[model samples]
Structure formats: structure tokens, C-alpha cells
Target: MSETDTLRDNRDRGGPAQPLVLAQNLTKHFPIRSGLLNRQTATVHAVDGVSFAVHKGETLGIVGESGCGKSTTARLLIGLIELDDGTIVFDGDALGSAISLRDMRKSVQMVFQDSYASLNPRLTIEETIAFGPKVQGLADPLGRARDLLGKVGLDPNRFAHRYPHELSGGQRQRVNIARALAMSPRLVILDEAVSALDKSVEAQVLNLLCDLKDEFGLTYVFISHDLNVVRFISDRVLVMYLGEVVEVGPVEAIYGKQAHPYTASLFSAMPSMDPDNRTMEPPLSGDPPNPVNPPSGCRFHTRCRFAEDVCSGAKPALATFGNHPDHLAACHMHDPASGHSLAGAEASA
Candidate 1:
């Protein structure tokens, strides 16, 4: 079957016949040290039992506010940080067991938010793109770099020799993309990769990303705070709050009918173009609670307008809501069997 056909089949089946990457019960916590002796006083629960899968040739957009573990999840997927608990299976091989870290790095790459900071100021654009392939002892590193520049819409002849300092923010970001593609990875983790650019430039970069994904047959884990961009680029969307995935489903399911209260609040915050059609729901009341001492049951209950007594007493499992088995949410209001309605609760004060 053609790759496109295969991808479509997988989507219809909820995921690929075999996922390119699978993370189960992923968890990460940073120890907070205090006092002169530097005793471990508290733990920062960066990623709390997060689980998800990336199918081949699919873009999974992760959306959440800052400190919601979007970037941390990216880092963990790429092996930039060690996981406190979890198993990462990539292309049928479990990470740290059958697959070595070096092998994983070659097949999975990442592009960070700050293009300028990620690129070496001293290195020319060509050199920056060539560095990865050179380290891996790939043949014709410079040729590959020049080819990538052209593929990403940058003229190799005109831009190859320029340093990152000489390029505009958009240009530098394109170069960053070239660098990530140097390894020809199967999956690319984009951690707010276009969040810093101007609106026009952001559109250009987003389009470029779409083109590259098709050209390379690549799967992407796109993490961003911009809901519109996430809706535009992602095939499926994962909604996280304070290190936990509160909801996950196809893009249509997420935008068309969100199940989690946190996910609904996020959509409500988006400004409407029509002045007369303002959202009735209030904006998120307060900043996300401190991650170190996150609330017991539902971490988002404190800020969720629909929150009830049950929401604070017992944790909800991420499960299918109603008849939509593919659309999952962690909320007490949804019962897998009966599909209880909580829409009225959301409308209440």
C-alpha cells in the first residue's frame, strides 16, 4: 500500500497497525533541594504518568499552558532527559533495552523554540545543518546540508555561508529545521518551534512544516500554546494540564466537541473575530496551581468552573466518552457506559 493510504487506514483504526513511537505511563519528577546541606525537600511533578502514541506519518499536536509538561514530554521522547518511570517503544524496539540511545537519536530529532539560541553563532548555516550528519559519519555532509536548505525553501547558494546572526528570525528557524532534518529522522519533536515568529512568518513556517512532513514521510509531535496553529497542523490533538493528559482525540473531536472542562476553558479563552459573539464562559480564573503540590484528584479542578465535589475527591481515568471510543477524556462527568451529560454543569456558575 502507498504510505498515504497506510496512514489513512491507521487513522481510521484509531492508530497505526503498529505505532512508530509509544510511551506508556511516562513520569518525570525533579527534586527540589533546600538548606545549606541541600536536602531534597520537595519534588516537581513535571510529567505525571503521561501516555500516548505517535503513529507513522501523523502529526500529534500537544497544547497546554506553560509548565504543563509539553516541552518536558518532548525532551523525554528524544532521550534528552531520563524518565523516572515509563517505557518508550520506538518502531517495535523498547528504548534503553533493544535500542541504544545513539540509535534512537538518529531516528528521532527535535527542533526547539528559540532558533537563534539553538544554532551556534559561530557556525555558518551550512555548517550548522551539516553538524549532525558529520557526527554520525554520513557521507557528503555538506552536500546533504545544501540539499536540505533548498528543500526547506532557503536558497543554498545565497544563505549557506551566512551565520545565524545574519538571518531574520524566520530564516534562522528554517535553518533550524534543516539541522533537524539532517539526520533524516522518522519522528520530529517540535517544541513551540514557531511561537516566536510574527503572524505572517508563523504561517510560512507552518506551511513549510506541512510540506516537509509529506516530503519526508515524517511523523511529528508538535507542542504549542497556540490553539489555532495546533488546529491547523495537527491530525490528532492531546490536551495536557499540569503534567497530565486531560483529553486526547482527533483534531475534529477536540475542536468540534471537547470533553474535559480544562480543554473547554482553553477554547473559551480564544478571542472571537465577531464582536457580537463573545464567549459566555469566564476565562481561566487563576494560574495553574503549583506543580510541586498539585491538587489531589483533578489537577485542573481548582480553575475549572464546572468542578464539583466529586472532582476534588477522586481521580478520573482517561477513558472513552459516549460512543466515541477514539475520543478520550479524564473527567468525572463522563461515564463510558451510560455517557452521562455534564453540559449543563459547564453552563452553570
Candidate 2:
């Protein structure tokens, strides 16, 4: 079926639609080398068996700590890094097989955290935005770039001639967005695209993103450490810990009734405006275990307060709990038959 037809079909379903991008068992590990020969000693488990999906025209926010492999996952999806294992299916086409790398690049574009670093310092704003379309052999590249600048709320006549260094952080980011959209991609992987901007500028960029998404029928995989921004922009949220997916659900479901202890801890860490309401128990304690020698079974067991013997012995599969079939968590506590109760569980919003 045509891409538009597929999108229409999914929209007509009136429920959770089929994923536009489906990643299953995605794994990427970096080898640790030592000595003169640089012989591989141990492997750093970056992304281990992580799996998730992004529905058409939906934003899937991936949130985790600094070394949680959110960036690696984004790079993997866009073919920036080679996957050691697993499969990525985009728009019903399996990557690396049915879809060629070039075609995949055309369909999926990425926006990095550092807008200045991502852009060419030498190129003018117009040139930078038009480069992608030019490389793709698209007609009227300059015209399209100018049009896109306007679409992204930048004045084409005024800002188009300026360089990356000349524009503000927020403006540069908007150019980055326009550059990504120049390819007419179906999916955009935003790796902390707005985290570096000022709050006011970030809001403006976010609003622009929302408008552009609706205008272009775009699907997004938004990776960010900022929970508030993620909550604002994402329809669904995926929580990752130690290179593994710990929870997946709608934003409201995950935030209102967090099922996973790690997820609860993350929410607990989110600074609240009400200073009177402080978290009693520390959300997290101690450093994360070294990825080179990761702990067995549940990766979060070392830090989770609700951890049990089973948690360290056997890995809990990500599964739905009770009536919330759409919300899934990888935690032994979610299993009622496993002699676990939610009596003392803390829900974070």
C-alpha cells in the first residue's frame, strides 16, 4: 500500500494504530579494549534488547538518566550506528533488507542536541537547509529552503543569509528542524533538540514543532532527559534504564500511575514547583552499576527498593498490568501471582 493509504488506514482504525517505526530486540554493545594491541577485553552493553514503536503522527518520548543509551537508540534507528542485533521496521518495510540505507535515510532524519555542532559553520542558513535537498537531487532547493525557513517561523529574507554563529540557539535549532524536514522524511529522531535552549525559546520551538507535525504528518522519536518537556511533547513515553526498556505507556498512564519502580524514581526526581511537597524517600541511591559488568536479571534491582530475590535471579518481561493493557512494565512487582502487592507503592505524576 502507498504511505498515505497506510497512514489513512491507521487513522481510521480509531484506536492504537500500527507502528510507523517498530524496533525489536535492538542491541548495541561497544567493546572495551586494553593494552598496546587494544585487544577487546569486555563489552559495554549500551542498548540491550530494547524494543518499542512509534505510531504514525505520534511523538514517542524516551527518557532516562545520562548514560541510559537514549542517544545510541536514536542513532541506531536512523542507521547512524550499526546494530549488533535486532530488527527495525519502518513504515511496514524492514530496515537493511526491504529498505535500502539510502531510502531509509530519506524516510528518517535526525536532529542532534547541539544545533551548532550539527550545522555547517561555513554554510549560510539557506545553504545549510538546502544542502540535504540538493544532495537528494530535489528541484528548486533554494526555493524550498526559503519556504521552509518561513514555515519554521524564520524570516527567509532576513535570516537566510546569516551563518550558524550569527543566529541564536533557538533560531539555529529551528534551522536544524527545517534541514531535517527538507528530506520530506516520515520520521524525525530528535535527540534533546530543545534541551539546550532557554525556556521561552524552547516553548516557541516546541510550538513550532507541533504545528509542523500537524502540517506535515510527521512521526517523532523524541529523546530527552527533561521530563517536563517530554511530558509536554510526547503522546507516549518509554523509560529506559541500563540499556534496557523498563516501561512503556501513554504519557497520562505512565505519569499518573507509574508501574515500574525505576519510573517512579525518575518521576520523584522531577523538581516540583510546590516546595512544601518534597519526596520522603530518596528516589535513587548509589551509582549505576558498571555497564561492562552489568548485574544479572533485572538491571534496576541494584537500586530499586522493592527489589526481591526473584528480581536478581530472573528477568521480568515487559508486560501489561490488570486493566491497563496498553501500559507495560518490566517489574516483578507488577505480577500479582508472584506474591507482590502494591500496598506501599508510590505513584508519581
Candidate 3:
């Protein structure tokens, strides 16, 4: 069977019919050098020991603070950046070990932030969308581009002829999304895709993404700092802090009943419509420690309210707790034997 047919089959069966994307112990570290000889200094652990799987037709939202390594993880997954250690498996093929990632580019595409900058100013909309297909030698490239433009809610007869400068912020974003689809990729990484758009426009674009997913059977690795947006678009949410996944599970569980203190802190920061719920505590103070010298153990121990001696000295393993079997978190608070219980502590407070 052709590659496209195989991909469709996999999607129909809920994955590579199998696992389309698997990231195992993925890590990225940039070494700091000093002096003329440029000896190896400290390393920035941008993405350390993060693992997850994205089945076909699923949107996996990766949420974290600005320096928490969300974008770095996205780049590592798509092979845009070199990983210091880990395995990236795409459609059963290991990308990290492969000689070149260029061959996988068509199958995996990215929609970057800053739509204005991502699109070539000199190229017209049609030229921009057709770039991928032409590069891949796809037959009927223009036809595909036009179809994609319409799919993204842009009229080929109109906007496709215009330059990026002529379109609104929303329009530019649509073109960016269309360009990712132009390659007919099985996996699409949206790195802060709508973070730059206005609220109303962001909703519209998100709706458009949902529609496109159903229509094209796409799997997405959506990276964003906007927790509400992530909750809306993702089937599962992965919460990261200081280069590690602190929690991951279904969206409802992570947002509604956050098990980890860090996840709960993130949810409390979400803008709520209920005025009564507006009394949530202020955001956690103190900036995340430098990645080059991250806190030992849980990494969040320094800021965590429930942190204890064990927290600073020994790292906690990810564990499933309470009612949600799918819900997983890495924190000392959830440890049964730790003699630390949020329920008891909250009551005393």
C-alpha cells in the first residue's frame, strides 16, 4: 500500500493502526562554554526525561511556563533540534537515531508562532502553501494548495493571491496552519499556534483546527502557555515544570481535579468566569531556577508549599492516585507513606 493509505489505515485504527508518535526519555542539553579553548561548561537541561505518545487524531496539549521546556520538547519531537538523549519514534520508525530528519519533514510539519515572520513576505499565499508540495515533488501541487486554502477558511481566488502583509493576524495564522497541512503530514506540531491571536480569533482558529482534525485525521502536539486553550483543544494534557513532566492525563482530570500541586497552581491561574471562584490564590512566586542548575529531587520542592526534607533530598516518581487511573503525577504530596496529605493539611489551614 502507498504511504498515505497506510497512514489513513493507522488513523482509522486509532494509531499507526499502531503508535504513530512515541517519545521515550527525550532530552536536550545545550553546553555552556568559557574561555578561548571553549571547554565544556554547564549544560542547560531544556528537555529532560520527558516521555509521551500521541495517537493519530488526538491533540496532546503540552502546557508550561515560558522557560519550562515545552517549545524545546516540540522541536525535539519533530527533529528540528538535536536531542542529547532519547528516542523519537514516528510511525514505528526511530527518528532520533536516523541519519537525517529531512526525510521525515513531510510526514511531520510544524506551525510556528509569529505568523508574520513564519511566512515569507516576498512569497504570495499560494506560493507559500505550495512550497512544501513542490519540495516533496507531489503531483498537482497547485491543486493541493488551493484545496488546503479553502480548508483553512481562506478563499483561493481571493486571499491566496495576496501577500502576508495584506492579511489580518488571524488570516496569517490560517495560512500558517494551511502550510502545515499542505504537506499532508500525519503529525502536526503547533508551537503556540494561536497564542499571538486575539481571544475571539483564537477561538475561531481553534475551532478551525478541530474541524481540520476530523476532516484530515490529524494528530497534533499542541504547545502553549495558555492553559485554557490547552484544556479546550486537547484530549490529554501534559504538564511540565523545570524540564520534566509533572503530570499528565485526560484534560478533565488535570483541569478539574488537579492532583499535583504544580498542576493545581496552573489551573488556579486560569481566568475563570465565576466571580466566586476568582478568590483563588495568587500565582506561585519566585522564578523557575536556571535550567543549568535546576533544583534537585522534585525540582518543584523549592516552591512547593508541601515540600519537606524528603522532597529536597529524594525525587518522587510519577504515580497514579485517587480515582483517576489515567491521571499521573510526580510529587511527594501524593505519596501515601510520606505522611504528607493535602486533604489533612488543607483542613488544618
Candidate 4:
């Protein structure tokens, strides 16, 4: 069986299929305020009605350009920031009184991009990893911390007493990963956790993550600007554009088809290794529109090559693109009733 099949199998493991984390119509807008009293001026649409699920034991990779609300989405998932709208259901329970934010956090943890800033300068590595379990009143926090350190390939005796400043970038990241796992979280939201390390170090860390996932039976929502890395680690790929999910499907399906125009452009922009296959023109033109005043209909209409009048008039719903129910795209081209020249039964069918 292929790697994709393996991922799908693991995702479909055990009894009835259910997402470990299910988010619906998630929205968050940062209100801009100015002047003496800090009066409201404009609202930056950080994440507008974004929704997706992290299946049990599957890594759902989120990919997009900078400032596309990737980190914000991660934060929203772990409840680091309160959602302006929408509901989060984790492992079958609602995120309010049913599960409780505090309880949810115990099962879900996040690893940020900045390795140095993420760890406390004051705390020793062992102290840092043990902190969460200590707070939870778990049995033998230090023992757990040492075991975690060993699992992450760090020598407990040598590195456990060291501070964040004492270790290298890769070592620091491993420590961060260990710290995140200290709570014995079932789902981990990794927001560019490997972006800071060098290529060699990155590969090592990525392998470590995969090995750890298998050992722990953990679910991951991996957010990264690195398309290659996303492709490497994801079971399903979620493509984001200016705070909205343009497309989401199985990793192989997405990398093969790229049904959404935005997703196509993103893949096109990836730098090729071969000199013969060089990119002549830009895959996507211009920067994303101001979130405060996005386009009337499709936010990507300004840069989309196949955009039609309908794209600027009607907001496309996130619907199944073709025969595959799991593969969905938010594009007028996929909707037969959208009235775009390329949208119809014949076009999509």
C-alpha cells in the first residue's frame, strides 16, 4: 500500500470515524482602534468563517502565504484566543460546559514558530517540561519530564538542567516538543514548529515528530508556509487564502489535482529543483487584498486567472468539487448554479 493509503487507514482506525477536533464557521476579527480613547476604526478580518477538522491520528496540514491567519487559526483551535464566532467540538463534546476550555487544553496543546520565545528563559529545561504536569497534579512530574526528554533524544542528565539559552536551535525545538507532550495531549497543533531550524535540523525534527506521533497516537494540525514540508507530513491538506479555506482534500488528491485556482497558484509558486522546470511568470499576481475591505465576493478574484463576473458577485460555498465527497473547494467553477462561464453540469461533471 502507498503512504496515502496508510494515512487513510490510520485515520479510519477502530470504531465509528470521528474527528478529534471539529470546528465550525470559526471567525475572528481584530478591531483596529486609534486616537486618545482608542475609538474603533476598522476591523482586520484575521479569520472569517474558517472551519476544518483534525481527524484522530492524522496530520492535517494547513498551508498558505504569510498573514493568511494560519497562526491565528492554531491559536483559535487551542483556545489561546477566544473566537468571535463559531463552535468547537472536540472528541464529541462541545467546547463550552461539556468539555470546558481548561479541560480541552489538557488534551490539546500547541507548538509555536518561535522556539526561543516560546520557552521561558528563567526555567530550566526539566522544569519547563514538568510545569504543565505539575500544575495538573500528575504523578511524578519530574520523572515524566525525564522520560519525555529521553524520548525526544535529549540526554536527561546532561540537558535536563540546562536553560533555553544553553541549547542549540534544534535542541531547543526538541525541548519545546517535549514540553508540549508533557501534558500527554492527544491532539497537537504545530504552528511552523520546524520553520526556524536549518534544512538538516528540520528533517531530523520532522522525523522525530512522525515517530513521536506513532508512539503516542497523537493527532496533529500542522500549519506551515513551506508547501514541501506540508506535503511531506500531511494526510489531508487545507489550503487557506486571506483568512478563508479555499480548498481541502487528501494530500495526494490536492497535490495531484489542485482544483481551486488559489491552490493551483500556490503550488505553481513553489521553487523547482530542476533548472529546466523554472517558473517564468508569477503564479499569483499582487498581494492579498486588505482584510478590512476585501473584495465584494471572492477575496482572490483580483488575482485569480479564471475569475468570472460571478466570482465578483456571488460568494461560493464550500462544496464537493467532483465525485469525491472529502475533497471540497470554495470556487465558482465548482458550483454548477454559480452561473460562471466555466461552471455547469458539463464543466464539473
Candidate 5:
């Protein structure tokens, strides 16, 4: 079937016009055993009641330090792993519902971090790109694959037969993107997609992604540890720490009027483009607390400079900011009930 046919079929089958990719109180826990009996000793809460939504055609950037469960959340949303609690609703359907994920696979795709590791060593670029379309039973799979390669700036005739090892790092990444796009997915989860490339190459790949987004009418869930890249491509940004969303707002609000201490610290850590007007703070100190037994109340309290007694006691719920309904953050700084500020709350670490 063609991309249009597939999309129309989905639309006709009672799907929402503006579909939402949402995680409603999603949670994941991994058991840690102590003995040969493999008895559950402890549980690592990788994602604890995390919730968010990715609207159609918008890029929602998930950013955090390593082990903050950003990737784990991605895994849960796409049904790569089973969730311990809550639901991942895509287009008003729960993940793993009677409708096999296999059907939705064509609409939702992922471009992994390491292109070299993601592609099969035995498969040629043509074979790799053709795999998805063929599995989805697309007509003229190879022709479509060749067209996707062209979209990614690769000459199909010259590069289609090459193995992943035969291609340069950037070339392999383009192939990976093409392979994912072969089925014309509505949403593409980019898990650190450009993290492994050289700076110059990264810029090229990023620009290519922007071009493709406009060309294909694609929505993206961009996951990355690099704040700079996230700021550049994201329409909205979510800041996570120890499996919870500490803050979420527009990209400009995140970088300019940061509410959560954790979010502010993150922007402050980024090296300023202008050296003379540097107010960027020093890098955060200490390791993130263990997820298995995360800190009480606020997960970021361990490292948050503004952490207080209340932060260690009352867990904050997402609250809207000054007159901006789109801006919501789970922090003690903004009172959801009153929409008022908390004084001296930002200076407490």
C-alpha cells in the first residue's frame, strides 16, 4: 500500500484528527535481586508516574542528564518494553491493546543514537531501508526505499549496495533515517539521533531533519542529553530527573524564564554563545541519586540548590505559569492553585 492509503485507512478507522501521543502516569520498575534464588530485593523506579503528550506535527524534546529515564520513557511510549503502571495512549488507543503494535509500527518509527550499531552488519543499505516497507507490504518497496535514500541526500545507485561498515558515520546515520522514513511514519522518536556525530556533521544532520520534518509533515519526540540541540529543534521541552518531569514549557520559556531550579541549572550549565555577558552558572555537582531508592518528595532535591524542607516532604504537581496555559511545570516554585510565585525558593541547594 502507499503511504496515503495507509494513513487514510487509519483515519477512516475512527482515529482522532489531531492525534495525541501521551503517557498517562506511566511507570517502570526493574527488580534487583540479591541471591541465586533471584528473589526481588529492590526495585529501581526508572520512570515514576511520568506524564506528557506529543501533539501532531510538533516536536517535543525530552532532555536530561544520563540515567534520568529519558530513554526509558521513550522505550515505554513505543512499547519496546512493558510498563509496570499507567498507559501510553497513542491516537486514543492504549499501547499493547488488541490492535497489535505491529499495525502501529508503520506509523511510529525510531532513529537510534549509534547508526553503526543500529543497522545490521550483514544487510546492505538497500536491504536495510527496504525491510520496513516490505514488512508493511508497501507496493514498489525498493523504489520507495530509493526515493527515501534520495531524500536523505544519498545517491541510491552509488550507495544502496554498500554495507553499513562501508559508509561514513554521517552517511550511515542518513541511511538509518531513510530506513525509518521508508514507511512514512507520522511520529519519529529520535533517541539521541545526532549525539554520536562530529560537530560539523551534526549540524548537517540536524538541518536535514528539519527539512524532512517540513517535507513529510512529521511529528518528533527528540530525546537528547545535549541541551543546545534540544533547544534548537524543540517546540516544547520537558526536563526530567530521576524518572519524573521536573518542568515542561515552550523552548523559549525554558531557556529564558526557567521556573524549576533543575531546569534553570540545566540552562545555566550550557556554555554561553557570548562570553562577555556570561551569567551561566557552574556545572551541577554530585551524582543523581539512585533510582532504586530515589529521594523522598522531589527527586531533584538531592542536587537542587533551591531544595528546602518542603521539597523533601511535599511532591509538587504540574502547575501553569503566568497567563500561559501551554506552560506547565512540576515544581514548588509555582503554586498551581493560585499561580503565584514562591519567594526565595530558587536559591535553597
Candidate 6:
């Protein structure tokens, strides 16, 4: 089946067009301290002015290499880590004004990659899932946990009393998914949630996730290095490089016509089933720059194939590219005024 047919239609959900989660100018820098007194040293630019939105009932996929801040961005979204500088708006209310951090957390939950570590070995399957609801003082947390277990394809009768070590990797991840759903959260940040599973098991979990999203009316922020998986599950795709969002657009648009050089290169690296259409040469070369001391202007300029003098000097703001609807890219090639020679006014507009 086509992605359009499989994914839920979230364009009109019987309300205002406002995004369910709005993040603007989100920046996070980790201080590197050393010496006897732990003096402040250089900062790791973990996330630099990253911004995007998660619409209600839509799965937003974030794809980037290691140290690109995908996990850090996930932490910031759900308040796992305090933001150095940024504003998060959840459900049309500014965080500090109408909603407290604690309150926002109840509406958001995260599922980490290491399912075994995420759960307490002491807690049984049922107890692990019930813990979140219990903290909220919800009545019948155990009952809710059992129901979620069934929804996630784990027969509660069989798995409820088992420990984390007794279950397979796939089963453990299912328990993690059930636990995330325990809070009845509107948004769930899944940080590499399925990357560790085998192929057949991964497909099962992916389908389970889609089923749960439809049944519970949930939104997801799926972060992973697997391009094929991201394309399969996401409604919109956001491309990041060196802690910056280089491009974001509908899933089909990103795969069909990638505007940024890094994005095109990333997609080109995806493994294909067709032997005749295999990638002849590597699309990307050279290691990514260090986050502590990144390049000037565009962080991607150093590795970008289409890099020019202007690209190394002027930072390109994320803007609409060409006539593609809702497509945005942070590259001089997409901005006419940036004077990269390849830019055009229509794309910049």
C-alpha cells in the first residue's frame, strides 16, 4: 500500500490549523568544563537554532547521523533536558504562561531505544506499564496497563508477570511502547525506538505503532538513522546536519526532490533492492565537523558538494524552496538574495 493510503489524514482534524506542538528557535549548548575547579571550557553546539512543528495525529521523522542532535532535540521536546534557550508551545499555550512544565510532561512521554534499560528489572511487565499512570494518581492503573499490553500485541495474561530479561528484544520494545501509552499522552517522542530490533520484528513493531496511533489518537516524533524506516512511518520528514535543521517537508517531497545538498546525499545512501539502480559512488565524503568548533556560516558548507564562497560566508535562513508546497531548506542554493549563483527568487520566496 502507498504511504498516503496508510498514514492518517491529519490536515483537517476539526479545529484550528495551529500545530499541536510548536518549537521556535530551539538552541541547546552543552558546556565542556575541565581543570581543577571545573572551569568553563568550550561548548558543544548540540542544537543550534533548531525549529519545527508536530501537527496533531501526524508522525514527524527526524533523520541525521550520530552527534547531529536528534536525541538531544527529542530530550528538549519532552523536557528531559532543560533548554538553554528556546520556547516550546504545546496545544496552543506557551509553556510558562498557561501550562507548567510538570503539566506539559503529563501530555508528553518518551520511549528510549534501550527498552531493557528503560524498564526497571525489578518491576514486572504489568508494573512497568502501570507505574506512569500510578504517578498521576489515576485509578486502576494496573487495569489500564493490561489493556495497553493487549493493544501493543502482548497478551497481558502471558507477559504481565514476566521480567524484562525473560522477554526477547522485540517483546521488550513492545513493553516500552505500552508504557509510553500508559499516560494517554497526545505526543510521544520515540528516540531510535525500533533501530535495535531485527527486520521482521521491526516491521511488526512499526505496524503496531501505526495501529496504536490510530486507536489512541496519538502523534509521534520518530528519530532514527534508517531512511527506509523513516520514509515508511513519517508524514513529514525533517533533515538535520551538525545540530541544525537543513531541510523539512512532506515525506514524498523530500524523497522526490531534495533541496539541500546534504539531504540529497543522505537519501542517496539508502540501500535499494534493485541491483541495477545501486549507488555507483558515495554521495557524501569526509567526516562531519566537530560540534565544539563548527565552521562559520552554514555548518554544512564544509562538506556540501555545491559549496561556494558565498555559502562559507553568509548563513542561509530556512525558507521555502522553489514551488514545492510547504518545503523549506537552509541552503544558499534555495535563497536568491544569498547570492550563491544557483539561487532563484521563486525558491527563496
- Top candidate (TM-score): 4
Candidate 4: stretches off by over 4 Å: 1-16, 345-349
Clash pairs, candidate 4, are none
**What CA root-mean-square deviation does each model show from the true structure?**
4.3, 3.7, 3.2, 4.4, 3.3, 4.5
lDDT of 2 by residue, 180-211 (tens): 98888878999999999999999999999999
Whole-model Cα lDDT of every candidate shown, in order: 0.88, 0.87, 0.84, 0.88, 0.84, 0.88
- Give TM-scores for every candidate, taking all chains together and pairing residue i with residue i: 0.92, 0.92, 0.91, 0.94, 0.91, 0.93
lDDT of 3: 0.84
- In candidate 6, which residue ranges exceed 4 Å CA deviation? 1-16, 345-349
Task: Write one digit per residue (lDDT tens) for candidate 5, span 1-349.
Answer: 3555556455533344545577789999999998999899998989999988888778999998888899999888777988899977677766678356876676788999999999999989999999977877888888888888999999999998999999999999999999988877878999999999999999999999999988877889999989989989999999999899988888887777887888878878777789798865575887777899999987887887767677788788888764457778777756633222464344342
For model 1, residues 197-273, the per-residue Cα lDDT tens digits are 99999999999999988877889999999999999999999999999999999999889988898898899899887
Model 3 clash tally, residue pairs: 1
**Candidate 5 structure, TM-score to reference:** 0.91
Candidate 6 residue 309 Cα shift, in angstroms, is 1.0
In candidate 5 the C-alpha lDDT for residue 346 amounts to: 40
TM-score of 3: 0.91
lDDT by residue for model 6 over 3-114, one digit each (tens)?
Answer: 2223324322335477889998899999999999998889999999998989888999999999999999999998888899989988788887878989888878999999
RMSD of 2: 3.7
Q: Is candidate 3 or candidate 6 better by TM-score?
A: 6
- Cα misplacement distance, residue 117 of candidate 3 (Å): 1.1
